[model samples]
Target: MAEKRDYYEVLGVGKDASDDDIKKSYRKLARQYHPDVNKAADAEQKFKEVKEAYDVLSDNQKRATYDRYGHVDPNQGFGGGGGGAGDFGGFGDIFDMFFGGGGGRRDPNAPQRGNDLQYTMTIEFKEAVFGKETDIQIPRTETCDTCSGSGAKPGTKPETCTICHGSGQQEVVQNTPFGRIVNRRACTNCSGTGKVIKEKCGTCHGAGKVKKQRKIHVRIPAGVDEGAQIRLSGEGESGVRGGPAGDLYIVIRVKSHEFFERDGDDIYCEVPLTFAQAALGDEIEIPTLTEKVKLKIPAGTQTGTYFRLKGKGVPRLRGYGQGDQHVKVTVVTPTKLSDEQKELLRQFSGTEGEATPQEHHETIFEKMKKAFRGE
Candidate 1:
């Protein structure tokens, strides 16, 4: 005894075959196995198998029945009616079914919000810290006054679309072997607006909007950093169909300073110190954000000494009180030497006392002391 082949295998398709897939496979197998085209002994048998598979799979009810109960007898079951094998005229037909008309459609006459706009503003470092208020001119669209936001003329009015019956859309239907399908698309007569203007406004040329410059006042707050955004309400482009206007966003760009580097709210800077002032105690003047302040240097101060000045940095953006300023001192080496100065330095070195550097700068100091003692 021989086993029966699956219907999906006969049509060369998966178990979940679509109508188009079954139709295509049936056409190809029918042309290949027909007695007029093929002379093989099994050609007639193969053609019958392909026809039976397509007839069962192409119908939704029959396919569901076959899936629920496997290998149902076609002669005694529901949806058993089959088309003749020579029904080639209906090969290119397609059908789609849609329920609840106008459920997913958008009305052309509905109000819509305007688009938001963005602008970049560059300011100096001091300006960002102190903040300022200024006015700016921006060109944007505005509603026309001639037709009062309508695209029609002053006396005449807009007419409803005749093609789509003022619905702004049209339905397309296609007939297939199983049933019919309907597709909804935008209408072409009135450009989906559902309204046609025979006579256009003179000022806006039927657009219902005009291009004009608007002056807006902006106030920048203190302690604003780079990439900060300030929003202005109702300052964007005009909306269509009497909708509300959008917002305007202003992005900030802070300029760099030549003498100072900022890290968050803290300020960092390097100051130069003379060799005499670093070795011996001295009080020097240092520049702060506001005024010059006096900073004391210890007698044994080495290079790269850091000093902090309270309440001298930039103001905090989100809290109370100001940040501190960090100052780093770099000792300047003397490039030129006088003859008398060199002799005095040599005599001082020959009779110098045993004074070592700080622990952090004690590199090679102990070795030099051992070499001097000959130990």
Candidate 2:
């Protein structure tokens, strides 16, 4: 097998591209490489590549994993196939786009998946740098225990709808000038359920589900940035009529650190240095994500100079290796000085061919007098 291309490269998008940008790029590529439309020999292969790339990039968790790991296994999360062209009504929409209308209507009576839920979770900066497990309380719909999602009273089953004969649909014919038009819509009597509950479930009021507070434990991956999302499959609301449950999305918000800031996987912090330390090289301890490490500041190092400490930053979320920590040097100036200290600094300035503090003050006074006298 050939080595796969990078997902971002395949979709012609940057690694930091937004979700909408990725979607637009994938759609354009998919339309161009669609086998039925392109008719080229390699169109099918290109289409598959586009689909696979979109499948990984469009999902937050998969994209994060792929970004850190370089490649993702097909069986990990891409196996079920829920994104890209397949998600846009599959080939039916493609055929409709080229050949014109024939898209089928979804069956209203079919078991519908539960609605996905979103929750914003705030964590400490350190917790985001190093992964942590925590629990959250969320209110979601759960299947009622009394009726077991049947929506009927205990010991009593739902009856077939009399209006549509339990088909969950009704057909109507209209006489028009063009011809007789036949149409099918959901059965009004049973609301497309094909059944009617004579006695509603006492616990859920015939809805077959009830809202309750649930405590869900979430394992947050390391190196998660602000606005990063963690997906919990089948942890959302319970489905209707025994359908599959939806997903729960945990949106992460990392609190700001007093000394450190994060950029992607890297950590950044500013370290203060004295003028003497900048002029004469000195070894100082700097704070990393985990601990303090010794950093050597070279002689004559200027303010705003950045020093990189490799493998001392946040760990990759799911891949090997760690990001580097950048320390920015900020030279501090003394606000007050003793007479002896000032005299030593003046003597040092005389050797360097610069004016002493008293000589500089006299020069400035003479300039002000000359300017005042227009000389």
Candidate 3:
């Protein structure tokens, strides 16, 4: 496989580009390389690349992830700042040694954001196409009401830690050949919380939070494809020390439709037509996303020919208008035939090329009808 280009580079936009700027660039490129409009051999591939880039950049969450971690390989999962996790860890270690910066020495009482949560939801194909509003229950940690997030009993309060003077970190000095090195570690006396609750809160057992189930209502929009995520703001675990709550991500898994196959917003399916119908042409009912509509098959239609139904596919995820539905027709040949039918076919074979295909088709239909009536 070839290496992929940067998404921003693919869309020809800067990292700080606005959402409208990204969408505008995508629309321009989509029209420029549309396979139906551009006849170049690589037009389809270019269109796919543009679509992929837009899919990532147009999504705020995905774009932020890309910005933080450049080019995360989908098959290999997310990598760190550089190389494997060990290399990233080693780099962090070197930085911490030079500058007094590490998580071990951080202020424990500082406000910290809660951890984000993820839930996988499987929905029906029609539900994904049409959208839905539903409720889900998930277990998460929440701040204790009784303790007021302080881990203290009802009438009591927490006291500052005696060790480390409420800094929550213990420091040590070592004399080296180059200079004296100062190392810091979390103070074990207060468990790095910078406060001690002599009488622990019975509700939370000295912790400032409690585990509970939360009900969240989610709205899945129309045209959501597989693996697409919906972000719910501040619906994750409760924050620590008055910090902001994290977000909850709902990942969608759309079940496969029995007949319809989707590619982007386009719908594709195949319909079978009998020999007479293919040769003589007919108006047949084709199923769209919403309803069944009549599709005209021109006379002398060949197998594998596709007819497009405009505005019959899925709605665009971001903007107005609907995609197209592509219907391919395959001709089915008869396997079992009556003796009279065989004779008629033989006669037609003897006179092959003597009449137009339409005439032959009409002749076969009439003969078959008469045979059915025992004429």
Candidate 4:
């Protein structure tokens, strides 16, 4: 017979390689040499070799025994039976690789937490700017009052599972070419709860919960933006058996405002100004999140100029202070003019050495080009 290769060498890992490293190396080799992917004549044998190496290296106890004795002895406490390394079949190793290795059993009667629930709420724009408290109704599972959440009929209790003896797990032993392999998994008979209800509750029909509509009071904080989420603990579905209840998440959706636009904590709005106001400054009333505020537009202010109103924007959701409001000015020109208004504008244009709008535009464009060229 051909001599067996070193397990670490077969997996291309060091003798002292970490468990994660060993697993990674084994997975890489297994994928490369798998028969379905690689049609090489020796691919199956190479795949088997990789699986064997992983199975032994992944198990602390088996790896320790192999390291000390140079090989595993099946008759000993660690090994399944007296067998050579080549005895390992490919199928059993593949099963172990996919399903996972052995581990301690779990108690089936343990309580499990309930599932969480989510609710999306739409609120007015002003309501998001300022905090509000509201009530909402939601349908969720509540503990069954009829049987006191035991899932058993009145005056009766759940009986321990006979298959797993209330341990909630079962031990499975399989004889492979590598020897006898042992694994512990959840009990099938009791469904891993290690308890069974023979006389089920009539109201819940063996389920420890019942569906009902519940009213919840939620407080939305000031300055909460769209897509914000609030968590309410112990407000979700009731737990299975006697477990603890889960939480409820409230997602907030703020409606759009007609005039105000919000960015972070800052608020912005556009205000139209007459041509005279742009040339000569004036105090104007602008809309803010809470109320209308007065803003001073400086003399000779151009279109698209911004005026700041400190502490007139949205409140900070987390910090102590509020944000400022910015007002963008848009100068409006008269579209229709009276004969007297036109004559005054013509005289004003004559003094400025521009007689027509076309001449004024060309002169300004020429000056802009010269300025840009540093003339």
Which candidate achieves the best TM-score against the true structure?
4
Candidate 4 runs further than 4 Å off: 1-47, 50-103, 349-375
Candidate 2 clashing pairs, residues 3+ apart or interchain: none
Give per-residue lDDT, candidate 3, residue 91.
26
Candidate 4 lDDT tens digits, 73-127: 6632432323444444333464455335443334456677999999999998779
Report the error of model 2 at residue 176, Å.
Answer: 4.9
Cα miss at 41, model 1 (Å)? 37
lDDT of 1 by residue, 1-375 (tens): 455577899889898777888888877876677544589999977766665667777778878777777675564253343654334223323211122252456788898788787888999877787788988888888888888778888998888999888888776765533223355677788888888889999988888889889899999987788999999989988788899898899999999865666788888877665566677768987776667789999886888899999888888878887788898887665545566656755775321222333443333334323323432
lDDT of 3 by residue, 261-357 (tens): 8999999877766766777788987767777789999878999999999998998899999889998887766665666666866775321122223
Q: In what order do the candidates fall by lDDT, top score first?
A: 3, 2, 4, 1
Q: Which ten residues in a row have the lowest lDDT in candidate 3?
A: 76-85
Residues 252-299, candidate 2: write the lDDT tens digits.
999986667789889887766666777677898776766667999998
- Clash list (residue pairs), candidate 1: 96-181
Better of 2 and 3 by TM-score: 3
Model 2 is weakest, by summed lDDT over 10 consecutive residues, at: 350-359
